[model samples]
Target chain A: MKLTKSFNRSLWVFHLNTGSCNGCEIEIVATICPRYDPERFGIKLVGSPKHADVLLVTGPVTKKMAAKVRRVYEQVPDPKLVMCIGTCGQSGGVFYDSYNLDGPIDQVLPVDVYVPGCPPRPEAIVYGVVKALEKLERLEAAQ
Target chain B: MLTDIILTLAGAFLVVIFSLIVAFFLLGVDRIVTARMQARIGPPLTQPFTDMRKLFTKENVVPANAIPWLFNLAPVVALASAITILLYIPIGGFPPVLSGGGDLILVMYLLTLPALALVAGGFSSGSPYATVGAQREMVTMIAYEFPLAVVIIAIAWKLAVSGVPLPFMLMSIQANPVWGLVGPLGIIGILILFFVLLIVTPAELSRIPFDTPEAETELAGGVLVEYSGKNLALFTLTQGVKTVVMASLMVALFIPYRLSALVPAPAILQPVLDLLFYLILVVLVAFVAVSLIRVSMARFRINQVVSVYWIYLSLIGIAGLLLVMADHFIGVV
Candidate 1:
């Protein structure tokens, strides 16, 4: 019970930088700070998607990162959430026309929330995380 | 009534703005927290603001097949619904700028509006990816709603038995945590709620492991395949505001201890200080949530999600409810 309680309270979020200028990546990092506090939502960023309840992917889906991104997505267990952290991840943003881009993060895995921005704001990321957590709980209930 | 509406409108607007401002700062905090978790230095506080400004000036586009009115309306509804939820929920002694007949149950449904709007927008886009996202969203909706509802219902039962008749709105719950969080059953309900709510947070916000609908790798932008410019910005803003809303909701339900100094102050200062205090608590909640994220892993399958919550959370919630009832009968309150 405690484990389940803690598991629910502490949702480990992972970040996958498929390919971007590092703009959204930095913002993603900003979300966990004391100021933005993703922890309030029971959200944290894990180094690996395997340990993440929510995999937060930033940047446009680049061809180079596609397979790796997919691999990471596969590693996350069931009831996991995927969040496309930026416009790039959503629709490729400015990178959409780039030959190296693979389109959006949703193309690779299911995304519960899409925080759209060339790089979205930290609060937006937090909001998106909360939404995903809500989705996670709802899914848990139905089962 | 007119005066009340005006006051409510004013309060709601302020809360909306406050939520937005808090969201940007929270974004900065999230970055810093995640960075430190990984042993790295994060960006400055103004980073999110700068990014938003940059996006505001970026090019806007509308897809040919998309319903322009609905597409434009989607993000607006999302933002509005989030802000509206915030308004209805009390943070500490603060009642939503507005309150009505229903309680937490109403807030729960109101919260789902943004997601519903997203699904609608996605389907309206007429793209395969968007449609797929909508479908995933629907499934996700089902996956999470039951457990959330169970938790809410349990809490409501507690409130009912206590004869407190909670506003069913989050604000009333927050204002009188003493009344809301009363009894051994209340505590158990809260504990069960802790798990249930924790699970609900990510899915509701559409964050990770469960983010299949908008999975960049599979559905591209998912529901947002064709959104751009202001429409996209609205969605982004909705996300930001919703983050604050979610955190605030948790704090409202769990931590209702208020700033002792605020009550003695002037009425105008009272609300401002109250708002600030609520934001601080939300920050704390976010910090705790982030710390938890550092160690946990995301669940992969949709089925697993359903099974875990339904089989586990439901039982837990039910147990808590029964325990509460027993405690009440035993005069253990």
Candidate 2:
């Protein structure tokens, strides 16, 4: 619906894992499958942050990955959005208050959307993406 | 002389525009067919256009260690050289823009320019992944070069032996469809050569099965890891154009038949019929060589790619050449 912004339709996502179990990653893969087919909306999982319009971050930040996450965030050029997936990246999930914990991802990056669960369902992640799109539209309107 | 120069310049401009459209069509068909084969409704046909527009507007990032000038220049050279090949190779119903100016050998050499530019860009990017990718790409180029040369040389040899003038010329090749010249034995030979070229097509375009150099999963975009924004957009455009170049080459070589020739039409509409038929051929080639192969096969290991081309495909291509040679001698006897 945001016709003016070309990136609105073609959103190339880069997936980053600070250090959670692979639950959110599996769900993300499911969302990209034939049934969900995010590619129908031109959403693709890109290999490099340089190629990404959206950064999908899963897992809580471990001590070492904190800097790596920030570096990748910097690598994704301007007009970028970050979505923190799963409760691990939101409130640290089961790893809450751990010694090696560097985050809740919001501490490390500006998260535009948060889909929280032990590992959020694929549908919930897709809804979170819709929310991200809405946020993008609002920002465009403000501009 | 001045008018001639003006005519050529104008013609060249038209060819550029025409090839770009065909290139976009090839990309759209590839993506949509790939999606459908996987049982999903794909993105719109104009997805490439939208993606290109978005890439142009995105920020161009020159990595800290990259040689900025070469990094920027590579994509321009790649895209320009890709368009350059179209100038020599006849497309649709029309003669090549610079028809008779260059020949098959020149086009063959020109085909390497874009890939060379890619290697230059990859090496210039100063990333370890890109360095490895550049090397892999160079190796892939070397591996496939022999089989491709075998296919072209065998065709031109047949034409030359059969008393055709300027057998290497694109016009000559297009004017005389190869299928007509050969006996049944030679027909089998030509089909094998055609098969060789078809397998090589994916490798030439760096699609799946031969996409080790740009292995997105392991190498993280590999040779293109450091490329972004307008530079990346230009590279993507180069890819689309190269797809058309390969498809056009295959169509011009194997299936040069014009629908207009079979179904008589108005003089004005003949070119339209020819162009439409050419497009269908191009799409079919792209589907078989790019989309279908890409969907069915996973990426080959770089070593496996080398063996497939060097050991297996080269042998197959040589056997094809031998059959063509044998058929020619037997006909004379």
Candidate 3:
């Protein structure tokens, strides 16, 4: 994937919930609030996968949601980054041994960054985004 | 004749560049001002430029279900039509490049072309969200057309009655400020018309309160749900240019006065002053019609959009038109 300096500055994110408890979703919303003001970094929450540069996935994928998650990941255009937020997406946090287990996200799609917490704080999500940008910068430099 | 053609071409190129720069600058300003209004620090003024660059570099995706040719053709058509409107409408102390070839009515028609292109793009995308958006866009277009026509026709009709030649010509309208042609009651009528036009400007540009077609929350970017990368960038540019076109039209029709005429400036400085004055007016109109209204109000439902334009705004527009007419007849008697 080709990348440029602009790719680092303006990152449009699309939030996806495979089957989270909604705690991570609320935290994601908090990250966008004026207190955090992600807009200052030119980060925007776009409505569609087509418009997104970053896929912000916030859940442990269930059997029913794994296919849908992959489809959405495909829907995002090339040169995209995926960040799995919350502990559920990292190790299925609370539902680690559930029968319908299909994901810790990376099983379903390649994730570039991971934010581990029961429900990661807004600061951690922001830090994860910073790390994602660092990865993008490294890729840009390698190119 | 060859030199004339080359000069005209060069001038057209310059206008395109100038309009693009100004439009992007205005967009950035709108973002900053909106953020301030919301009590938060906004992105830098150059954010739109960076965003555009990123969009241009991203992968262009063509949905499997989409008609590639028509889907791609729409953004090009939209941008072209938007720039074409600028060729006819006077900009910043300069007469339109194609002023002699077209007039107000032609401009009115040209205004619809960009929106039509958008609708075409939406329908061709083969996405249910986009299809619904196109239908809503068509409905919004139909709703706004009447009040828009009323405002334009009222001014031209007033000019025609006053024995102005080529009443529908934008040059003629610019030469004769609509404000100077009316009595006290007619002035009130013109003010009312101006207010109606201010309300129309946002709807014309598909901003908030009239952006039901692109309701990001409900429709997931709606008409633009399927577009990506380069095509999306072109649509964004088209939007910025369309804002310039609409604001410039408002400036030409209602506030065509030049600073050069009012103050004694050196001949060299006159155009500069007038251009600055014109820019100020355009920005003011944009701030009021777009930013202020957008900040203060919520998006109207598509049905509510139709009623607001067709019922409330149209009634206000006609009342203003009658006032202008009554003022004219009252003066004659």
User: Which candidate achieves the best DockQ against the true structure?
Assistant: 3
Model 2 misplacement above 4 A = A1-4
Chain B TM-score in each of the candidates: 0.87, 0.99, 0.99
Evaluated against the true chain A, what TM-score does chain A of model 3 have?
A: 0.98
Worst 10 residues of 3 chain B by lDDT: B91-100
Encode model 3's per-residue lDDT on A1-143: one tens digit a residue: 68999889999999999999999999999899888888888999999999999999988899999999999999999889999999999899989989998998999999999999978899999999999999988888888
- The candidate 1 chain A region of ten consecutive residues with least summed lDDT is A1-10
Q: How much DockQ does model 2 earn?
A: 0.58
Say which prediction, candidate 1 or candidate 3, comes out ahead on TM-score. Answer: 3
TM-score of chain A considered alone, across all candidate predictions = 0.86, 0.96, 0.98
Q: Could you arrange the candidates by lDDT from highest to lowest?
A: 3, 2, 1
Residue B56 lDDT (model 1): 45
Task: Give the alpha carbon lDDT tens digit for every residue of B249-288 in model 2.
Answer: 9998899888988998999999999999998898989899
Q: Give the winner by lDDT.
A: 3
* Residue B157, candidate 3: alpha-carbon lDDT: 99
Off by over 4 Å in 1: A1-143, B100-102, B166-172, B178-186, B261-273
Candidate 1 on B68-150: residue-level lDDT in tens? 88877888888888888877777655656766654677788898899999998888877777888888887887778887787
Candidate order by DockQ, highest to lowest?
Answer: 3, 2, 1
Return whichever of 1 and 3 wins on lDDT. 3
lDDT, candidate 3, B1-333, per-residue tens: 899788778878988998899889888988889988988798999998999999999999999999999999999999999999999988777888877789989999999999999999999999999999999999999999999999999999999999999999888999999999999999999999999999988887889989999999999998999999999999999999999998899999999888889999999998899889999999998999889999999999999999999999999999999999999999999
